[model samples]
Target: MKNIKMTIEYDGGRYLGWQRLGDSDKTIQGKTENILTKMTGSEIEIVGSGRTDAGTHAKGQVANFKTSIDMDLPTMQEYLIRYLPQDIIVKELEEVPERFHARYHAVGKKYSYYVWNNVVPSAFERNYSFHYSEQLDLEKMNKACEKLIGRHDFIGFSALKKSKKSTVRTIDEISIQREDNLLHFTFIGEGFLYKMVRILMGTLLEIGSGITALEVIDTIFESGIRSEAGMTVPAQGLFLDEVYYN
Candidate 1:
């Protein structure tokens, strides 16, 4: 068997999410698996680097699957692109080592949340970004972001329920930047809990608008309680920028 690694990009505006559910709903993984099954005539499961919640886009999501066919990498990619839905694109394909697992072997992941802070939201970006009419203080946002960098218990930034064994994770970097009417928050971490990045973005926005004190961010981190943080931002504004493996 040959392990095929693929870099995928998708506009998540119409899918249920990345993973397949028994609800028979459309999903990114379900669509890919359907195409692969038609090509290989066998049931195949493609392991994804991570799960992106519904309405979250991806620029460089990774996945891997084993196939017994003799097709070359280029040929497989061509077939996948020809058959898969238009919103999803296969960016690259390569044969990887047999033992490689996309989620398990991932070392780091980067995510970006976008906000449009204009008086009127752009029609094109309405689905891709969160529109906030309030003026934001960039300096205050940056100050609050400093507390998010480094390892800590991120319970306040995560969802209420998680099956993961631990809530402690390392955040390698956190950056807040604004260009024109767009505000971008980028997060790089070893791993993340469900809705962690979204909740962090919400807290930072609260600080920028003077709804919360800058030092309150540090307090939330230390409190280790989900209710200590602001509301979880909408998933539509979040994007999986990249996944790192080594």
Candidate 2:
């Protein structure tokens, strides 16, 4: 069997998340796997680098699958593009060594959250960004970012109720940038727990709005409690920006 790695880009506004579930065929993974199974005439299972919640987008999501078929990469990419939902597209595909496994091999990932700070509605970015009319202090937000950039037990920031696995994660970088009325938060990390990025963004947004003090981030860390953090931001504003591999 040959292992194939594919980089996909999708507008997740219309679909369920990346994982396949019995409840819906609108998931990105289920749709792509169904198409590939039909084309290859075999049961094809694709392992994604990670799962993105419903309504969250991806610019460079990665997945790998093993197939006994003899088709080349370009052909498979073309076939996927043609058959999968219009919102989902395979930008690149290649045959890789049999040992490669997308989820396990991924070393890190970058996630970005967009916030529209304008009062008026954005026609073009309406679906991709979350609109918040509150006046945000960018300076305060940047200061909070400093505390977020480091290795820490992020159990307080994650939406996960319980886990036997370690909640510690290393955040390489956290940056907030404003371009006009749009605020972009970039988070680069070794790994993230369930809804971690969204929860972090929510806390940052509260700090930006002066609703929460700058010291709250440190307090949340010291407390190690989920309720101490701010609300979880909407999924529409989060995007899996990129995946890193060694």
Candidate 3:
């Protein structure tokens, strides 16, 4: 058997999520599996590096699967491109070591959230970015983000009472910047809890709007309570930028 690795990009506007759901419903994994089953004539399971939430986009999501086919990498990639839907594309494919696992071997992940800070929304960006009509204080948002940059419990930024063994995670970096009317927030972390990025964005937005005090961010970090954080922003604004692996 050969282990195949693929770099995929998709617009997550219509699908439920990346993972395969029941009955092979609308999903990035389900669509890829359907095409793979047709090409390989076997029930193949592909493991993604991460499962992005519904309506969340991706630019460099990675996945790997084991297959017995003897096809060349270029041919397999070309074939997949011809069959897969337009929203999802296999950018590259390679054969890797047998022990390579996309999710398990992942070292870090990067996510970016985009916001259109304009009076009116752009039609072209409706599906890709979040629209906010209020004026944002960029300096205040940056100050708030500094509180999240290092290792912390992060319980306040995540959905509480989840079935996870631990809510403790390390955020390597948190950056907030604005160019023109686009507000970009990029996060790099060892891993993340459910809706963590979105919730963090909401809290920062509150700070930008002058509704939440900048010092409150530090207080929330100390509290480790979910209620101390801001609301979870919409998933449409979030994009899984890339997944790092060794």
The candidate maximizing lDDT is 2
What TM-score do all the candidates reach, one by one?
0.97, 0.98, 0.96
**lDDT by residue for model 3 over 24-121, one digit each (tens)?**
57999999988988889899999999899889999999999989988899889989999999999999898999999999999999999999999999
| lDDT of model 2, residue 17 | 92
Of 1 and 2, which scores higher on TM-score?
2
Rank the models by TM-score, top first.
2, 1, 3
Cand. 3 TM to true fold:
0.96
TM-score of 2: 0.98
Compute the lDDT of residue 215 as modeled in candidate 1: 81
Residue pairs with backbone atoms closer than 3 Å in model 3 (clashes): none
Candidate 2 clashes between residue pairs 3 or more apart in a chain or in different chains = none
The better candidate by lDDT, 2 or 3, is: 2
Give the clashing pairs for model 1: none
**Could you give me the TM-score of model 1 versus the true structure?**
0.97
Candidate 1 residue lDDT tens string, 209-243: 88888887778777777887887888889999899
